[model samples]
Target: MIKFNTKTNQRSDYLPAASYSLVKQINSRGVYSFCMCPGGVIAPCATKNNEIVTNGWSPSQRNYPTANSGIVIELKVDDFKKYSSFGPLAGVEFQKNIEQKAYKLSNDSQRAPAQKLLDFMNNKLSRNIPKTSYIPGTVFY
Candidate 1:
């Protein structure tokens, strides 16, 4: 995994549990992994209303071949300068836009946009994507 951090603190010996309790406030953004599923499969996380979101969960034994984590980046008031006119609702608007854009880019389907790991880092699109654990599947974009 590609870890990005400049911290020198060693991680706790305890097995990391739910991320809901952990909050990292940086640049007015609450950065945390939403659901951490070790040895789990990525699930189709769209709501009944037809919005695309991704989530993962593992069995108690965590014996699956794959593991996934949903990292969430929350925007704070300062990050909504362009939408300051919306006041407190700016963040909501921004999130809605992101979901809508993802739906549109994926041809209004449940398929999620995906790219090769190396291709993504090199800023290039892969001609083909490897198989994924995502059930709804992914469309290389």
Candidate 2:
């Protein structure tokens, strides 16, 4: 999930809601925006204990400062082949594993691991996180 800086021109206060899809390279995986929520919050949507999943949603007024969305990559069946031992549920198992990993990484709590966009691209941890809509809070990781 990504949150736009409302302090800037990217704020949802003026821009209309939008979504995007892009392929960075030929024959490579495509990334697309999902659940684009203008002036929305990042919700914890985990369905099981010891796991972490996220979704996005906007309030009725869509008046929050930041906009957020799920920037998802197109996944193929082959991506879960490593978990084929799970049979027909390989994909589910794969997703579960990821969620569990996130849970573990965040010290086994509801707090989500997060970092600033620029810091992430620079392969470094953020010194501090700005205000966000995620209510359970965040831990830089």
lDDT of 2 by residue, 28-124 (tens): 7775547666778898999999999878888876777676866566788999999999999999899999999889988999888887755965789
lDDT of each: 0.66, 0.77
Q: Please report, as a residue range, the 10-residue window in candidate 2 with the lowest summed lDDT.
A: 18-27
Candidate 1, residue 83: lDDT: 72
Q: What are the TM-scores, per candidate, against the unseen true structure?
A: 0.63, 0.75
| lDDT agreement of model 2 with the native | 0.77
Choose the strongest candidate by lDDT: 2
Clash pairs, candidate 2, are none
